[model samples]
Target: MEAHALYELLEKYRQGKCSPEELEQLERWYASLGKDRPDSLLEEGSEAAQVLTSRKLQELHASLGRERRVVPFRKRVLRWAAVVSGLILLAGGARYYFKPASRQGELVKEYRIPAAHSRHITLPDGSLVILHAGSRLEYPLAFNNNIRDVTLVGEAYFDIRPDTAKPFVIHSGSLRTTVLGTAFNIRAYEGSPEITVSVTRGKVKVETEQEGKLLAVLTPDQQVVYNNMGATAVRQPVTADSAIQWVRKDMVFENLSFAAVAQSISNRYHVNVRFEDEGLATCPIRASFNGTEPLETVLSVVCGIRNASYTIEDENDILITGKGCLP
Candidate 1:
């Protein structure tokens, strides 16, 4: 199932509203999806080994009755930490595993991206994340009973799996996006002038880092853009299909400026692209091209449509100069 459909179906199942057939479909879907393993098999001392140990612990705890033991929360957490640490040691190489590292229990595991490189990741709970270049995501390896949370730096598109009991929370720089299983996009690159959250499906609540700032709720197709410029604007919902067209290797532009389009293309292709002429910076253009297309071909097509001209300087920079340029 696609992300949105899976989310909806999961939500319905949780609410006791799904038909029997739909529930079966949900089970089938869950079983069909599995994590991608690296080349090396996980040893008992590896991180993955520790994860398996943690899962066993969870199974043991589940068998306990609601009448419950009198174990203190702190002690319980520490015990789990030790188990997880030992497992990581078995899963990964033993030399790097430290007990302290286990205590750093992340509810979502850490996600890393190389400079100028974006990546698609699947969360432990089956949610999806598209991390922009040079971004990091810190989440616990697994979410315990209550809140599901994650911290993000940079940009990502989220296709969350619905589980109302565990509302998904994203801490992106100074902003937070909260949802009970929704699809959304967040752009909060460090040093970027602004933070943005655009909702494509379901609903999301956004709040500023500073307290007392009222939550901003977004409906499908809506976007919230906020920055220190004292500007917080709500815009008519743009089609998320267009916003995330990069996922398909297609770059779509509807009256987008040359500079903006170039930035997006750069991120998509993991390349440095420069425009030599300031005059072409503000030029408005409408076009769509696969990201894998030759850079020269893309520029040529855009220039041809506008009756303009361009020249590549040593294949690194492109200069577009012409009368048709809209400044």
Candidate 2:
């Protein structure tokens, strides 16, 4: 995401040598950067479009807490103009592997995991899958063109087979994750506002399923959290192993925010965690728990880390109080 690296990517894109994910990234960038700007800008030969195009660069600068200088815009705009100019071309050249409608009487296999239960199965292409509790997975009886595609309604961990010529794609809600060969986890349970993809090995490409807007290209230990309702995404480093601990019916936390950990616990135990101060919600936690541990024991350990105390109001909700992080 550095300026020089972006420039290199653009150059590679121009040469038609960029990988599938890279091209999708550039396309998504152009889409997001050009949002609500003006069609005339692109039609008018990028005089004003240049101004809108530089916003992406500026947005990156803003995120880094750097001062924006008018002096740099003039020079940077020229490099960005080429990317904006190709938006139309990218639209025309766009190719997607998804087929909206199945063939008449197509042989599709669907597996649904009940609540509080998990299931493991081998995909048609020899890929391995472990579905979390209350998850569903659907796929064709056999893959076509060496390209495997599956739809997920909840969370799943996959160990995909290597196939350079074929890409494996997973569709979850509005998020689409594409991988050539990777071990990754996708969490996209129904009615959840956020969908997450975490990679343990190899590379993965996260994108918007409807708009084909690339979200992020992730390598090992990388994760992208996409908020479907908010239409936003954040990519961050993670302990990939911890993210998929659900496969073992265990809880793993590695510098994860208290708010997130709370959600995980609530989902597993069918209880909500409430806090008075946002500070408590933001506390960083590092711990692991066996699935058999009682809920109160887990809360006790978590609160002890932050010098906090929790009192269960009922089986449905619990309250925790603390000043902030204790250590």
Candidate 3:
């Protein structure tokens, strides 16, 4: 089930308002969570693994209410709704895997994007991440018990969920960024000369990971570029929006047929595209867009690369004419 549905169902359970069928469904879900796993093939987000996490979470609320003299049971469970919602997403359809964490106590889940591609990620905390090509992000399987922490490689733009009590932290190479709530970008590729942190909204604090030395406190439109080898950093002002312009529909087509590109363009631009010479559909095109160009501009570039020309028959239909694929 979806996160919202799970949440509504949880509320119904807490209110003692669930029908027998709903309760039966909940039991089946829990049964699935407790399912046995193949001994040889273990992985994070596995049903058995989630059973441990879910059990711990459920136990946490109970122990708090019993031993810690915590709030009432109902109230405490209600308070845990946020945590539960995030867990539902983990079991939902996010692409991720687990790695050994620093503490060695629990595994950290990681999401990676290969070179020449980008992906959008919704963190367990509901924060948004636009991971650029050749990047990876690592975080806990569930962001429930501790502060929000993540490790980044390469680059990504983050729109963090605001939680004043718990700060969000990112470790990118030697640089560490801490913020309570903000939108920012970090570019720190391996073997790169430097790591850069740019803030678009709210405030951000940049520091050295090892020594915890303060580097810079940045506000909107500000950024810090740190020379990793030299351990020197320069803080400056910039057009923050420009830094994030790549978060748009930047895409790459590697050795793709014109017909495939046409279909993709049509899907993206909400238009129909056709070829006068069917042979032209076989032409291979390799191109990348930084995402700022308009549809016409993109099509013009694509057509030029293929030694072809295109015309707009109507606002929604495009016609292309060209010689067959050039050698």
lDDT of 3 by residue, 246-302 (tens): 666535689899999887676445456889999999999999885434568889999
- State the lDDT at 68 in candidate 2: 21
**How close is every model to the real structure, measured as TM-score?**
0.46, 0.46, 0.52
Task: Tell me the tens digit of each residue's lDDT in model 1 across 245-314.
Answer: 6454436788987778767655553334555566666788789763335456777887776676777543
Writing each residue's lDDT as its tens digit, candidate 2 over 220-302 gives 99999999888999999999659877765647799899988887777565565889788889999988874435567889998
| Residue 145, candidate 3: C-alpha displacement in angstroms | 2.9
lDDT (C-alpha) at residue 119 in model 2: 55
Q: How many clashes in candidate 3?
A: 0
What's the true lDDT of residue 170 in model 2? 94
Of 1 and 3, which scores higher on TM-score?
3
- State which candidate has the highest TM-score: 3
